[model samples]
Target: MAAIEPEATGFEPESAVRKMSGFSLKPAERRALLTILCALLAVRILAMFWYPFVDSTEARYAEIARKMLETGDWITPQFDYGVPFWGKPPLHTWMSALGMKIFGVSHFGARFLFLIASLGLLAVCYVWVRKLRGHDLALVAIAVMASAGLFYGASAFVVTDMAMVLGTTMSMAGFYACLADKSSHRVWGYLFFAGLAVGLLAKGPVAVVLTGIPIFLWVVIGNRWRQLLRLPWITGTLLTGLIALPWYLLAEAKTPGFLNYFIIGEHYKRFLETGWQGDLYGSAHARAKGMIWVYGFIAFLPWVLFAPALATRGRQVLEIFRKDRTGWHSYLLAWTLSPLILFTPAANILPAYVLPGIPAAAILLVSVWAGIFGQPGRKTRAWVAVSMIGVAVVVFGLTTVAFFFPNTLNVRSERELVQKALETSPDIAINYWGDRSYSAEFYTQGRLRYIADSATLEALKSNDVRDALAVYSHDIPRLKDRLEAGFVDLGRFNRRHLFVEPPLQ
Candidate 1:
């Protein structure tokens, strides 16, 4: 990891705080680094196009967006038609649905907006790091962040967390820019609240909590309380409300009990209660308290592997937090640690929750790397670049493997199964015996339904449409003798057995 010593120097013109940094990269070296970063990004985009949306999480959201698109109800994202989904706001779904409108509802269409959002967050962080350090350091930061475990995995995956990450990044970047600028700070000040609005819309109140943590800690620890007044508070709150409040209000009006379920049940009970049973749409993801820190370690990988780079310059790293007037280093530390700290006590968490902190962690790591290995020679710099490139290549390789052998990776998508079922019963309404698959809904365009009982199955059949049953091998015995005797089994697709109406003897 140390072979390619990263090049960086602190550039805090607002307070003139500088870090002890390493040698600058030559033009050829910089170009090489840039080329690698761009290539890796292209690979990430290709992964998005090549891979199918896996079952449950990715396909669930994609199905919800597809439903939203079909229903023309822009106000609420439905878990199923007539069932309003209050788990999250419509920001990610809105964009994904818009992407589907323009591109058609395919893997690329459903996932394209997420890639745009992830790259947009990277862009914001890249510019912020460039202002604090130079081109080389910024390059190191984005390279580390973009290839990190959770960030890379979620780059184009259809999840709500990416939009929230973008919100947190924008807020963190705009806040620091406001601190750094010598004049004309009003625009940046408004940007801080604009980020708040985005975050609120993207996830919920948690976005505000994520952004506020670092700012509060930096202000209190640095005793820089007077800086708060410089920002435009009165108008900013109004702007945030204008953008985010209407949706909350409108959702509650459209569907009663939405606000109560979403705000209190989702944000409050779900966080503090393990195995929280209040979830209306899906089961809660519960982990042990403080598990978020462990997830943080996993999510920040490849960069987390380089902790010794920062530890080697422990004194300089500590001194920046204690002595730097611009609050940049301390701010980065606070920003990177904020999500981990906040979710440490929460019983429900996922690895993607760690994403908001990763960009700051990468920037901070590269800054310390530069501080420790001052003027690392050309050979050492090349080694550092190779180390980073190797990690990224490994990530791309994993994606390639997933593209080729999804089943090997335990990737669950009902696309092929649905397609195979259609060939067997072209006009038959395919139904599951029990339990629904979101990927089936997405692949079949919301036509897939589950048989709650014999009555529903008979009712589907009475519509003069032959209703085929796709039952799991294990679940085949659960059906009545009529179904088991009256149907022709049409072979297995994955674990499920598709059955069509019996042939006349």
Candidate 2:
């Protein structure tokens, strides 16, 4: 693939940037850009290693992986010891479990694979864009994508979205290769299905929908329906089924009703119905319809600077489909907009649902820049500095506050409490006196117990078995009222105080 005409993308081709599109960055600017990218990645890696997994999302997933490893139930992820978590598929859990198995189950172990997944996406962006538009603009695209709030966070954050988005990107890339070049299409065709398998396993059928919409729109609008035949559809569908169906079958067998809940409740009702209450694992996050558009802007805030230009630019990206020179414009535009379009009418949406479109958004933003400005210069460096460096500074500030101030952000991690409890005496099991702490469950290697009643608490106290209780801050007075004196306060974490009974004299 040669350099795509900057005009062939999202905006008018008559701009000064079209002339500068061929220009490579000066060595100094190139080094600076590379340095900034490396530094941003380094910061995220540090945060991944340093930060504790918080409750309700990160720790929830981490503990599930820990339980999966402990129980050896690879087919179904558990919300509790035996209860199945039907909320999502098992790909992200498998990755984290594998990481924990290989690296030892800490934050880094659970989260390491996501970092790899994100970097792999970045590499794909760089190579694909480099092939289409040369080196300079590719770097610009990478910077733009890497800095987007959603992408930056998802780079190492433990969520199913990154893997699902990676699959979408793979589908886009592999589909483009199959459609655009007939000379070498076999492997790329398979890669397209492989992405489908990944997306299906990582999230669910939504992966196919997210990738399919752009593909269908692009193929239909271009009248390149025949080009899709170039793909190995019969075999591709088989491959996807081969990879994804086993888990679905196994999960439903292990916990019947998974298909009905996941396929119908999650995929359909969760999105269409406002304030949907059918969710089993978590509450529905129902926002106003079309808030996804707002989330799209916020997610891509760094490069959303060109949003005004997009008013005209979107039409131009579509205009190129008719010429069908390479189908690149059609591919980019459809892939980028598909998520927003899919979620536009859904009342239940999360900002994370906006993730699938970030890569294509990054690509189009840089294309818009090249089509409009035509070359990297002082403004480019300043923009990267503000975008990249400014984000770094905020991360640093948050890290400092998290470590020093400790309670300002009210981080919901029980790692510190677990560590202190073991230090007090690693021999006894600890109980959470208030809400369940998944982080505690994870940090304790499933040794955490919940105090179900006062009789259970008194029995342990009377038995001469020195016990530990991680009492939530709000429950401290109640705990004191239940068991007065004869306890040592070990210390406190965000919301919990670890109190251990003193040995009987």
Could you list the CA RMSD of all candidates, in the order they appear? 4.7, 4.1
What tens-digit string does per-residue lDDT give for candidate 1 at 1-505? 0111012222344223323234356678778878887877787778777777777899999999999899999998999889888999999999889899999998889889999998898888877776667656677678778877788878888889999988888888887676555464577678888999999999999999999999888778767666677678899889989999999999999999988888899889999988999998878898889999889988877668678756776887676556545556777889999999899999988888888898888888777667666555676566667766776687677767666765566567766667777876676677888777998899889887788777776565446666677777787776756566567787776657778774323
Worst 10 residues of 2 by lDDT: 3-12
**What TM-score would every model get versus the actual structure?**
0.90, 0.90
**Candidate 2 residue lDDT tens string, 1-505:** 2222323432223234324355467778889889989988888888887777788788898899989988988998999988999999999999999999999988888999999999898888887677556677878788889888888888887789999988988888887766555455777788799999999999999999999899888767767665667789899989989988999998888889999999999999999999888988778997999999999989987678757755666666444345445566557878889999999999899899999999998887777655555565687668767988877777767766765665688988887777777887768768777678888898898987888677877776676666888877777776686656556787677788888888656
lDDT of each: 0.79, 0.81
Worst 10 residues of 1 by lDDT: 1-10
Model 1 residue 151 CA deviation (Å) reads 0.8
**Reference-based lDDT, residue 37, model 1:** 75
Residue clash pairs of candidate 2 = 17-373, 17-374
TM-score of 1: 0.90
Runs of candidate 2 with Cα error greater than 4 angstroms are 1-23, 306-325, 490-492
